[model samples]
Structure formats: C-alpha cells, structure tokens
Target: MFTSTERIKPDAQTIALYLENVLSHKYQIPTFQRDVVWEKENVKKLWDSIYKFYPLGSILVWKTNTKLESHREIGGIKLADNFHSHEYQYILDGQQRTTFLLTSIYGNKIANKKNFNPTLYIDLTIELTNVTDDISYAKRFLFWDEIDDRDGQIQANTGKKKPLQR
Candidate 1:
C-alpha cells in the first residue's frame, strides 16, 4: 500500500506558532485522543531537551474530513468555541509534548491530579546560566507562585545568579 506523508523539521519558534494557531481553532484534536497527562517533571524535561536542541520526536497528524467534539481549552488556554471545519487535522500522537509546549510558553495553567490548575513557569535565571555554561546546568522547573522566592533560594545555594539577558 502506498501513502503520501510529509515530514517537516521546524524549529521551536515555528512549532510554537503552529500551536498558537491550534488555540485559535485553526486545527483540532479529535475526541478519541487522550487528554494532556504529562507530569510537571516530564514537562520540564521536554523543555530542557528543546532548549538543548534535542529532538523531541515527530508529531503525527491525520488529514481528514472527520469532525469530532474537540477540546475547548488545552492546558488552561480558552480556545475559540466550537469552530468546526470540513477539513481537519487530527492529532494522532505527541499530545503530551504539544500540551507542554503550549502551556509552558503561553504561561497557561495545567490540571493537576487533584483537579487544581497550576500555572507553569520556567526559571529564566536557570535557563540563562545553562545557555552560557557559566555553571553546571541543573534542570529547574517552577510554578507561578514559587518563582520569586525560588530564584533567590537557588542563587543562595549555587552562588551563580546572574541577571537575565534581554
């Protein structure tokens, strides 16, 4: 059997842009797909791999006319309401990675096991240090509430706090 498939290797920024489009209802996730289930640690590791230019693996989408009830919000971003189309690309895989990317970059909250939504934040301070190799890179992920106090604590412990570059 012969099939036509296209493979694209887009940079992180481009991927982010596409996700923004998804939020806008330009694409849809079929109801059959699982909900976002990546834990906080997993989300952080995904970002770390991307930051290091490590391949996170390819996303699989199916182009079809099938329209199903899709997510109204993903990772706490309120998507446009029930905008349907005759043509849709159903996300068959990479749901977790896509959710993490959307939530982390857009500063959206994710649902925890207790059903509480917590906002995600990347420690800009830690990311900067790692990028410059000024200190041993330790993967750090923080929630919105902990960011302010945690930065100081990290500095005190590591003695490697530097101003974040613009």
Candidate 2:
C-alpha cells in the first residue's frame, strides 16, 4: 500500500553493500526478480569497462514494504525477506555492473561463486600516472590493471571507460 521510492547512482560500490547487507538490507529483490545467471565472462567485461572510465549506467532499486514472490535457488541463498519493514524487488537494469562490482571489487560472495575473491581495491594515492578525472583521486580499477596499469592511477579500462562529459 506504500509507494515505492527509487534511488539512482552511477556504477557504484552499492552492489557490494547490498550483498553484504543481504537478508537484512533496507531493500530486497522480489520473487519476481530474474535469476542471477551472469557468468564470469560477463562480470569480467563489466569490470573491464568500468576501469576504462566508461559509464556502466545506473543501478535501479525499488524500496517498499510490500512482499513479493522470490526466485528459486536465489544465488545460492535462501529467498526469504526476513525483515518486514524492508521489502522490494531489484529491477536490475544494470546487472552486469552490479555483479562485477560486488563480487570482484568488494570480494562479496557472489551468487553461486563462493570461491571467487575480489580482485580490485581503491588505490589511495593521489599521485597518478594516467588519471584524467582532474579530481586527483584514483579508483585503482583492477579490471585490467595489467593492461591499463593499476599503480593507483585512474585508468578507464574498467568501469568509467566512457568519455568524459566535459
């Protein structure tokens, strides 16, 4: 009976937070949500694009208090919206981006991939070799570090590969 509120943000670390807070997060993927079937290749592509400074698009999530059906084998975990206050469906228009960030960057246990470890981390160094954001901060994208260089520089062979707005 409540109107759903949607939050928007570019490819972010949001996915990691969502999974980490799974079962107890402020929002939940409805049963009607599609199955998480993205393979490692898809995930790899996403991370690669992101590191390239390309726009992975924004992730859309609905937040409400209404319960809904859940998919089977929901990512190697039980599908029960344990909390009543938070109920919603993850309309994953950007599933590729979400999954990669969560599983590869944050090291979150991705659906069906318990053995995978996050390969990316924030390089907390302002001194850059190829930073183009002009923001002095680098994301240290590990997606293609070998190819793009991960020496604490903001390289866009991964998530933010798209051209800059300016």
Candidate 3:
C-alpha cells in the first residue's frame, strides 16, 4: 500500500559527489538542525571508518517543493544559495557526518579553537597486519597537530621528510 510520494529508494553517492553538492548548496541543513559539535577524536573515528572501507551510514534527505529556512554555513564553510531550483533537498538527519566530511575536507575555524586545521593525514608507512584487540589505528590516522609534533622529532633525527599524506 505505497503511493509514489510514500515510496523510498536508496541512492549511492561518492564522497566527491557529496562534497560537490555541499559546496554547491544542493544539500542543505534545516535551521532546526543542530550545529556541528563533534570533537577532533570523533572526526578521527569517522575518517578511520572511511579509510577501512566501512559503511558510514546513510544521510536522510527530504525532497520537497516547499522551501524552508536552512543553514548557510557549517563549520565556517559557506554554501552557495540555490534560488533557481523550485525543489530542494533538506537533510533530515546525518548532520554530524555531513559536517565532519565538509569540515575535514574544507577545513574549519571553530570557536575557541586556535588555528584549527581540520586536515586529515594518513601514514602510508604503517603496515597492515592481522587485527588484534590491542592494536590501534591511532598511529596510522593523525591530525595536523599530531603530525607537527612527530615532524619536529623526525626533522631533528634525519633532516626532514613528511611521512603523512593529505
């Protein structure tokens, strides 16, 4: 007993496409949606999941002809306004995930955080071995600050060569 409007279908989108839409303002967050609140550790975990090819869950979007007030920015990244389109897709959930993806890739200027660099780095030198409960990915995935600290030690040891990739 499903009508056309009631039927739901799943669509797969690449990270590139998602980010493009975010930059273009095709995807919008409703005004009622909560602000970005995820800390650095939380962001690291999310990127870790992606690096392992794990499912990052779905972002629910509601398409409607009715336009509603939406957030123009997330984590200091400004989204363009789409006035030509009569239809809009408002994100009903997945605000945190969306924000993380946007901020990590686009960088952010979070309040009270000085010189926050949301850039994520992965150590290609790290070997992939058999998983154990004691094993951690902390060394493999790092933030800018962590890499900076390690870079200082590495620079002092044998000249300078960054190990992490952007």
TM-score of every prediction relative to native: 0.67, 0.46, 0.77
Deviation (Å) of 163 in candidate 1: 19
Task: Report the alpha-carbon TM-score of model 2 versus the true structure.
Answer: 0.46
Q: Where does candidate 1 have its weakest 10-residue lDDT segment?
A: 155-164
Q: What's the lDDT for residue 11 in model 1?
A: 33
**Per-residue accuracy of model 3 over 69-143 as CA lDDT, tens digit each:** 887776666655654468888889887888778777777765435566766667766655755422346666667
How well is each residue in 52-147 modelled by candidate 2, as lDDT tens digits? 567666667655465665442333334444544454655446444544554564344555555544455445443445545433222333333322
Give candidates' CA RMSD values in order: 6.5, 10.4, 4.6
- Candidate 3 residue pairs that clash: none
Backbone Cα, N, C clashes tallied per candidate: 0, 25, 0
Overall local distance difference test of candidate 2: 0.49
The CA lDDT of each predicted structure is 0.61, 0.49, 0.71
Estimate the TM-score for candidate 3: 0.77
Candidate 2 ranges with C-alpha deviation above 4 Å: 1-24, 71-80, 86-89, 108-166
| lDDT of residue 95 for candidate 1 | 72
Rank by TM-score, highest first: 3, 1, 2
